[model samples]
Target: MLFAIRFTDHQSEYNVRKHYLNYHLDWLKQKRGVVLAAGSLREKHNDQPVGALWVVKAEHEEEALSIFSDDPFWVHGLRASVEVLSWSLAFEDMLKD
Candidate 1:
């Protein structure tokens, strides 16, 4: 199943995210699931990253949660809130195959 993981940064702990960035990206690359898309939610004016969004294809929600638990950022308390939702993509036109 596909899932969208929406993460919210802690208001006062945003600066803590830098500590685990490398570990987070590395885990993403080594994971088996497909990361269809990923990015941070930006502010309206300054375009600062206040949160994150990830689209993942995994066997189940439990598997997806496992992947998330391993992220260093999650461990360091940089992620204040997280929500995972089942998702579907309606188009394949943009796909290479």
Candidate 2:
């Protein structure tokens, strides 16, 4: 199953996300098979990241959660909350094979 995962950033400067950024990227690379896509969420006018999003392929919601729950950012408390929803690719043809 495909899952849309959103990791909302904690509204605090104490979240230490930048400190573990490299480790997080490394981990994401290792999980690329399951993590089809990922990136930070930002406002329209500014470049500040408000959260992060990922598209994951997993057997179930728990499986999807586990994939990101192990991320360095999550382990270190960069996320305030997370939402997992089953998703379908509406523009599949637009993507390269």
**Which candidate number would show the highest lDDT if scored against the true structure?**
2
lDDT of 2 at 37: 88
Per-candidate TM-score against the hidden true structure: 0.81, 0.87
38-63 per-residue lDDT for model 1 (tens digits) = 77787785765688999887899987
**Candidate 2 Cα outliers beyond 4 Å, as residue runs:** 91-97
Q: Per-prediction count of colliding residue pairs?
A: 0, 0
Leading candidate by TM-score: 2
Residue 93 in candidate 1, Cα distance off native in Å: 4.9
Question: Every model's Cα RMSD, please?
Answer: 2.2, 2.0
Model 1: lDDT equals 0.78
Candidate 1 residue pairs in clash (backbone atoms < 3 Å) = none
Q: Pairs clashing in candidate 2?
A: none
CA lDDT of each prediction against the hidden true structure = 0.78, 0.84
